[model samples]
Target: MSDRDTIHAHIEAHIGEHIANIQRLVQQPSVSLEKTGLRECAALLVSNMMAAGFTEAETVDVGDDYPGVWGMVDCGKPTTMLIYGHYDVRPVGTEAWTHPPFSGEAIPFDGFPKVVLGRGAAAQKGPLQAWINAVSSILSVEGALPVNLIFLIEGAELLGSPNYGKLFERYRDRLAQVSALYGPKTAQDASGAVSMTLGYKGLIYLEFVASTQSTGLGPQGGAVHSATSVVVDNPVWRLLHAMASLTDDTGRTIAIPELAAMMAQAKPIADWERPLLDAMRAGVAGKDPNGFIPGLAPQFPVKTFKEEVAPADLLQRYMYGPSFNISGLRSGYTGPGTKSFLLPDTATATCDLRVISEVGAQDIIAIIRRHLDSAGFPDITIRVMAAYDWYQTSLESSLIRATLATLDAYDCPRTIWPVQGFGGPWAHFAKLLGIPSLQGGSPGHGARLATSDEFLVVEGDGKVASLATIERYYVDLIYAFAAVTKQ
Candidate 1:
């Protein structure tokens, strides 16, 4: 048998051990925001990497932030591949779950034949563990992989990877030698076809605060009788009016002229994006694009609603379009029942601008300030909470070609997305270090990442079906990638 066949056999032989190790990894709580079990998890990852035949593996500290784990295995190959994944997961908010969020329990559900339900099961921990398993299998069977390997797993991905760029900068010389970067693909549409996202949009998270002391538009004191509203201006009303000026009546398009101009100048759909657009159009025509996400359809303006929109238009607006979203709003009283008859002293709205490749977060914030100042709300304070620049890989890159070939080899129904609709810290390596990066892995079909019921599907047949697909895909990807000759 060929070396590739040998690797496949090894994977099949050790599949059970791989799944058990992944369960153990998922059982560890490494919530980045809460700093829960971060150090312990990093240590565990190091130990696992060492056992996988990595020559060196250690946890690198990024100032006060959570630690990032780095590992390397040199096989004397001509090419090196850098793999990136996050060890941290989103906070498990107050959502009633069927099982413990940290319990990597394999349960049999209807649509999904078998699934491992847990916090980081599908978002990353599961896929990362699968990569480790693939590496182990390949080494144990052949004593060497086709290409050199470098692993950089961070613990602050959920926190916008505030310090990841620094880590990349610190290890620039070592990282720059790598030919390409790899990450697990977590985006699956309603059709259940696994997708390879070439890039992601940038993000600017900001909070707009309007208070009597700052804006001089609302009541100066804490709480006043509702009857006093005749004389006292409500900060909530003022803030609402200011926000209204930022968006049109439809609330889908940005009304600020300068911001619109920036988006137009920065983001132009190129030829590489055609395939993604076509897939999105097909998805819109076939299924309710909004069905996978509950309660999201009604939030769109009537004209921009999915049912009312054409396929091409919907893809353009939802995928390529920039957005101004109000994540949360806080004002007077927010009790259980109702507490009326009082004017709040301050009002604040937390918003995020889903940016494109052309714009920077600081520039967007500056433009917002300019718009608000010109609109006669100069006193409003805009605080930038966090920001991440966009990243896009070339469609013709070796990494992408290898991914497409692997998916085609497995007969996995696949879609090619030019860029993900969400924001990520991929720019740290892809754009900053000048390494080509592509997100590809086994099917993460029903992993409700960032939600209370987050899970990873495991198929009964060890295939790429809903729950059983990840390990096999990683094995295929590693082999296909090794076959690619660096240009």
Candidate 2:
């Protein structure tokens, strides 16, 4: 048999073992929200890393927070690659789920192998395990890796990765030596074609709360009954009226004057924008109606019919623009039947603003505060929850060449998104280290990330095939960087 065939067969042979590992990892609840099983999970990963042939693997504790696992495979090569993966996962919503959120049960199906149901099954654990499986297969066949690997597994991404800064500061010297970095949440085309993301947008999440005290109660302060609505100024109506002034009917423009200040700070890079715009149009022909859960449509930022799917409009909105959203709001009683109610003594709303490059979170918050003050809602209270700076990468860098060559070697199709149109922490690496970073992963296809009924169909050769894809791309990346360093 040819070498490729032999390698593929070997990977297929060990597929069950790799899958077992994934099941074990998924079974251990690492939900970051409840602080559940995080340490044990990190230890489990460190053990797996060692078993998979990583020589120096250890779990670094972040004080009271979840520990981040770090490992290195000394390929004895001069060049190094920093690979990042998260072990933490978001808490499963309590209300609806096909299976218990933590139950790692593999349910059998007709055409496909059984799938293990659980949170983090797709968002990361599966893909992370897939990477290890691929690396193990490569070592089994070749007896050595192609280049140096610096793998970092963090357990705090779900909590906004707050401690990442301190962790990076501690290991700055070691991380700085790496040639390039890779992270999770990548996408391939509808036909399983791969693409490289050259850049990403940065983000800032904030919450705004507004409340009216005794003022809305018609000057009679004693929680008046609903029948006296004629005299009382209802807080619900006042809030609705004030919020109406924030956005237009079509949600196209912010009515606040301070929006101009935030807009002026944004600077869109050209090289990153063109390819990103092209990818959106060609990525998916039609938006899947069943892609999201039923009744969850309201949660998505924007819904688009095929007729309104303007690629330019979508691209512009993603990169060089801003979005304002009311995450959630509540005032009066919310339950089964409607009861006679008075204007709530207090009403509150939470808001989040997504900023592109050049927009600072503090600046955006100030603008929002100024606008609320100018709009005569000075009594409203705004609390900033999570603040992050915007970041982007240069598409012309040598790192882009490595990413493109790797994706090309893996047979990633041409029509898929060539770069990330969304935002992440690209600035931390790009702006801080002066080196470009990339975000792409093996987690997009199935319904596992933040959705229920999520399952992974274990095809006979699928695990082997996915591993081989990652191996080719990762090894190609090593060679690509070697060439760059030599030049």
Candidate 3:
């Protein structure tokens, strides 16, 4: 039998085993913020990799809370394929779920088939499981993979991957060996058509605390009564005015000089986005394009929103360019009713800056500090809450070609995305280590990520991507990587 045929057979033979292992992986709670089951999750991934013929599997400890899992299967070829994914998940925010968060229950639904409801079903655990399953299935059938393989799994993805730089620095040699990188296809539409994801936007988050001395008459600094309003300058007003200087009525125009400067150099919107933007403008055509809007309003120009909010335009704004947003703010009194007092000491606001290409968090923070200082709000203190670099792979890269080939092999509809709208720390894999990273995955239809009802559909046949469908994606990927590397 042909090598491709043999790999497909192997995957088919042990499909059930793959599902059970996926359930086991999903069951482990690896919330990074709470430090819940992080190391255990890393160890679990190591075990799975080892089981899948990766002879050298080790959890690289970078110190801090959670470490990364690194493993490799050497085929003695010059070409190496690196795979990047996170093992950590975000906190289960306030949401009442139909099933327990970490139960890993694969119970049968009434009108539908069975499913695995748990934490990380869509945000990532399920897709990670599928990768492991694919590797195991290939090994079961062929006894050896076609191309050299490397696995880089981080445990602190949700916390903005703080220690990822240190880890990447330490493993530079191992990462340089990669000739191509593999990522899941996350491109999909509401109609259920699937596509491949090419790249993701980057993020830099900042928290600014504006403060002043306690403004009061008493030695103990107690707030003054309503009579003091005319004499005392409210810190809240000062903070609000300073923030107002950053943006105009329409959020589209940012007032910060340095931020505007950096954005000037951002890559022009890609061609694929035009059609999608047109679609979105048609969907939601209510708001004016020129005026500043909150929520989804900024995405579509008033004329475009008058049309529809195309899925493509929504995706483009997220993947490419720099986006600025004020995430949250805190300043004073609504206790019971209206307690008459301007907050004395401080008012703070957290801002999120999403970057596309070369914007650095530390650099951006310095620029912002300078801008605020020049704007006469030197008292506004800037803190780097989180930072993640942008990641992009050439559409013409052999890795992308291989991915497209795999999709074709499985008869999966192919809608190509230049990048995902939301940003990620994928730069830890791409820029830091020069590893190509993509954020697509088989999270599946109707999987609600971040919400409590997150669940994974499991047909009785036990195929994560429909037995025949997933097997082809795996087999084709193995074949394509092997061929590309051999050249």
Top-TM-score structure, candidate number:
1
Which model, 1 or 3, shows the larger lDDT?
1
Model 1 quality (TM-score):
0.83
Model 1, span 1-487: residue lDDT tens: 9876777777777767777887888899999889899999999999899988898899998786589999998999888999889899888878788889899887775366677788998878887887888888778888988889998888988766767776677678888778888886554544556667777788777889888888665567687788988888888877898999998997877899988877776577787677677766776664544542222443342433624665556656666777789988998888788898888898899887887856677777889999999999987888776677888888778888888887787676876667666776666677667778876534655457756778766664333453224555676777777887644
Runs with alpha carbons beyond 4 Å of true place in candidate 2: 1-13, 63-66, 74-77, 94-116, 136-146, 184-186, 209-252, 264-276, 279-320, 330-349, 369-384, 394-396, 416-421, 441-444, 457-487
In candidate 1, residue 382 scores what lDDT?
87
Off by over 4 Å in 3: 109-112, 185-192, 211-241, 249-252, 264-266, 269-321, 330-348, 357-362, 389-391, 432-435, 441-446, 460-464
Q: Kindly list the per-residue Cα lDDT of model 2 for residues 1-487, writing each as its tens digit.
A: 9654565577678866877887888888898878999999999998888888886889988786678888888778776777778888878864488678767666653233466567887667866776676666667777666667788777877666656666677688987877777664435423464444555545555544445453433433334566667866666666666677788876666777767655666564466566666656454335443232122343464465323545445444454566676767876666678756555555667665665646466677787788777888776666655556655546566666666665566555533233343444445666677776776633223344676655444442342224334434444455566676566
For candidate 3, lDDT tens digit of each residue in 58-102? 998997888898988886767777777788877777878777788
Models 1 onward score TM values of 0.83, 0.74, 0.79
Q: After superposition, how far is residue 183 of candidate 2 from its true place, in Å?
A: 1.4
Ranking according to lDDT, highest score first: 1, 3, 2
Candidate 3: worst-modelled 10 consecutive residues by lDDT? 290-299
Worst 10 residues of 1 by lDDT: 292-301
In candidate 2, position 330 carries an lDDT of 78
lDDT (Cα) of model 3? 0.66
Name the candidate that leads on lDDT: 1
lDDT for position 484 in model 2: 64
Q: In model 1, how large is the Cα lDDT of residue 481?
A: 77
